[model samples]
Target: MVVFRSGLFFLAFLVIGGAWGQTMATVDRQALAELESLAAQHPSSKALVLAAQGHPVALVQGRATVGFIGLLNADTTPTAWRTWAQAHEAVFPGACRHGVASFRVDANHLDVLEALPMDRLELASRAVPNLDKARYGTRVDSVHAGLDLPTAFHGEGVLVGVLDWGFDYTHPMFYDTALTASRIRGVWDQYRTAGEAPDGFDYGAASLEPWEIQLMGSDTSNVYGYSTHGTHVAGIAAGGGAGVGLTGMAPASDLLLATLMVDEAAALDAFAWMQDVAEADNKRLVINNSWGLPQWGTPDGTSLSNVFIDGLSEDGVVFVSSNGNNGDSNFHIEQTFTTAGDTARSKVQFYPLSAHPHAWGQNLTLWGEPGEAFSANFMVTVGASTEVNQSPWFNTADGPFMLEAVHVAMEDTFVYDVVAEAAHPDNGRPFLQLRIHKGNTGLGVALQMTADQGTVHAWNHTHLSNDVGNWGQDFQAATSGWLQGTPAYGIQQPACGESVIAIGAYASEYLNSQGTEVGGSPAYFSSHGPTLDGRLKPNVSAPGVNVESSLSSFRDGAYAVTEEVEFDGMTYEFAKLSGTSMSSPAVAGIVALMLEANQNLSPSDVRDILEVTARQDQATGALPAEGEVEWGHGKVNAHQAVLAALNWVSWVGHPTLPDNPTGEDLMAQPNPAQERVLVSGNLSAQSTYRLVDTRGRVWQEGPASPVFRIDLQGMPPGVYVVMAWDPELQTSHTTRVVKTQ
Candidate 1:
């Protein structure tokens, strides 16, 4: 069930954003014509949404929502910025120094604001949801045994951040049983408007104190109760499994929590909140994000979320995200417009992933070449046209009849948005269909959507079949990995960030009968990738299928549980769930162990160690293809990864540097050193030097150095300052060096 922050229904708007240099005002017709041509090639019997490029034009104006803008560097004063936006009738809701801000305006006014000559500003529609769309022990024991790890390495001092839906903080899994104290440090709920927001953040429903959570127990009604996705995810990452025997990968790690709204602006805010908490607590942090934007394919890693991830990565924050479960779903399609009149079209069949299969909606965001104009149509198809299921719009022998249709011409050059939300007239099952007509075709336009929502498949228009294409087995377009071709593109946005460690799922079914063996193959549903930019992902894989973890009070009986136990007079249950969501937290838990081993490991270092220590897989006892697309480096070996982190040296440093002094100073050779950096220059026994990160945390120091080799193997990837002093010259030399690898 897709849940939105209350009171945000009126703040929804379409966001059309491109890189910093793209001209938003320019519209290309040839691109549009090409998309149309691709659409024309598809058959007519199946449902399809024509793909287009351009600013989203309203299909049927229903509601006016809020829009967002990221100022170039946030250089504008609050007063001046508000004045300019107010002139356009845009209401400023919140602003972050990170160059992000939220504003409310009608669709028409938003258009006016978009046309304004605002340099360095990025715009996005605060689109609302269409209502669509691990741990532990038994399987993890194999990983521990494989790596020969010590029992003391239980993620003791590390903090794990969960940027997901609301969590059940009161669960015994998140408390210190001996003292009955909460292990959750803090919570920033963007949906609760009743309390204060976290420091430096102005929005969110409420903030939770650890003590308040301990008092609430199972009274987690402040969060969405429709399902316990967040709760389950958190449990897999760090739950203690108190009364229950189910233990997570890092049961001893403390937690920092935040409940996010579906909006990107809110997500950015939540990221900042968690980072602030981590910094304040002075804890080595690794954050897990299992949620993603559904039905939106942004393989280009230039979205605002990517920007945030990049910025945070410099601060030595580790982020792990799910690769999504669309591996087998037809929610994504990419095809080149080879001929001038050729078209690419598909059937957007909807099948519910929620428990309430009949209630759901899906959103689609299409992108085509610049200056392309494509005609788009959404055709709704229903079951057989009997008395119980009849629709005047569709007419098919097997009962695949159309109920309603909507069409539009996309002239914008960047992104075109469409939503399929109407329920089937007969059975009331949710369905989303599309048909596109491009005037010309020479370039490729890709279509992407959420996988679990339903099926969307491409077919030859002349040979169109009556099949709805919604079956799980046949659903296979929106795969998350890079398409096998030149200029590889296909990492899902947000998760595509360089600093983000995207995780895939390892199935229990793939394991040996003993349940202690590693699987050579990842779960069929785990999204795979060499990102659109050719960056390999997911960095690693972990046990995800049928893993049992803590259950939420609100959803106690919604799903079956494996065990129930009492803690502090309250009953807590352990339930089994699957998906990359489970795999990601398992990795997050392992990261916590890594952090505990070496607090200096940078995000890049964490990713590298995991990949280096990952165990090569031979699915079905067959050697993996040299360039495997799905399994990434390999299945994660918790013991090996942790051991590598324990023995590995840090080579990453922060970005930026202070002014360097010139003349006969101690010079560091190989500025961006990978393993070792040598210190050179005239020096005596009394000469001394020190190397430290941007935060001024010194890592190395040596006395009497005419020449010194500084081991950068222990540093994280980033910029660091080196200070040296010579008693003879009586001058301290400060130089900046970068660490890579």
Candidate 2:
């Protein structure tokens, strides 16, 4: 029997016999241990512990605990679970197509849920949003400059979806370039519960129309406190040149916004909702994720969230994410042992509680190669030499999960907990996680490790009260044998995923008194990457340094206002912010333009186009063909990328190509013709040919012979459609051809 405290009373649940016992036997031991640790650390909130079940906890209406539950398999629907929840008096929020669902339950009834067969149960992990753009640096201005040809793309007919918080829906930047109408197709506020949720989901308020968002004014406040992050990101991706005269990369694209719940699970829900909206509207969608959590998953991109993003990518939804902003922080260490009995040591530096009020302590995450093991312990010291207390050595091979805390008393008490694992199920790597609490302000912390064989990587991250941010801490070589940390492998989860187009940050160009000049360098804080499994990441780089964009007027605190605009009796503002978060949207907006040019392109196709068209200059210093750790494929080139997209459409067969009944293919020689194209196949003397551009305007129409030549001498360079109608068979065959300059 297990006893759980619920309010003033205690509830006892049986987990020893019958079907309940069998279910408990199959539960993930690591997850169970994590939950037990949380319960022990926070005994006062038994309801919170039960609801979280080792996951991060979010309180709904200040009472119920909400978390995610993964079903046993794809065959198992959430319907049965919903029924079970109802019998146990729990609230089932909704279900996602990936066999995951959200549930809210009281602490007392949580034990009943434990008896149900489940593949996994995850509590939401808190995530911080990454916070762009000099469009000319990426040549996006060239695309917006317009071409004399018919193929002019300003992200028209494409959907740009942003998943972040702090949006001022009434901002003029969300409207059309003429300010005559709103371009925001919809907005889903996951934290607000007073309105209708998006279709197919039971939580959050959904404003499908622009008028609804205008009435609400702003989303509900979150931990960030009426943030301006989401608004700024959106403005950079697709904001019209409303007030600042600085237009986003995709100014003519439609916008779909979602103020997330600051959790991994909620982000998944947002993706599903956005995709559904795009499908309903019959438009291609590109989602920009400017936030990430380093502690949330394995950095090799095999985590559930990474897999989910990959699945979405295959379904035609493109995902772009920020690599991270920890490039300047020395928070990562990699050590290898050539012989037995090799040891490594580093002194942990904790962030002060004064600057970070929610700073609980620091977390040291250590990972070793498969079939290899390592033992680690923490040492507390007074000043530089006096050892106050030393934690017990916890070896990863000893058990799947081990939890212990070290306590010491001098002038004040000092304490910290150690959580070790024999092998993480995700990648079969030996893992160790330590949560060092801020006990005595004067105590010093250090980590010591020993490994028999193989390499190990460790990262030190500052743990906040809500687990929302992954701000790094330094590892100093305080002692003779201690090693100093480096800034390599700083890319976080989601960004490390194979299918996600991770973006790095670079400084944009600006003119100084010394004449036209460019920053033309990687941002100091842009994270470096080559995922743990050794895969090149940060597919491309974009401008992220002090880029100007819209700001939320509803922000509660003081902020530096760079510019302001007055419209309809409301005052809106714009400001400059910097981070990888800003750069991801710049690429996403460019992706919108590519999609506008060719809607049939897949996620992989889009990635290839961006990489092949990326620009490399003196600032990049002759990067390798495979790309570099910091700059990826160098700076993004929007003009070349869109042109490549258009060219690709011609080869893959255009979407507008009509089916031919003649059982013969239409052919054009010198497809990318410089001056003329030879049209042949399935043609007759009585055939009439029409040459049209992308805008559906016929450039040439005339009678054709079996082997005819179409002159392209005066026509502008662009993709053109060629249709030939055979009057004898009363059939038409069409093909797309590219005209080069």
- Compare the candidates by TM-score and give the number of the best one: 2
Candidate 1 lDDT by residue in tens digits, 165-186? 6467677777653426667877
Q: Please state the error at residue 56 of candidate 2 in Å.
A: 3.4
Per-residue lDDT of model 2, residues 72-101, tens digit only: 444456666556555664554544555555
Top-lDDT structure, candidate number: 2
Q: Over all chains combined, what TM-score does candidate 1 have?
A: 0.61
How does each model score on lDDT? 0.52, 0.76
- List where candidate 2 sits over 4 angstroms from the true fold: 1-55, 59-62, 69-71, 78-88, 91-93, 100-108, 147-150, 381-389, 409-412, 441-443, 479-481, 513-515, 649-741
Task: State the displacement of the C-alpha of residue 184, model 1, in Å, after optimal TM-score superposition.
Answer: 0.6
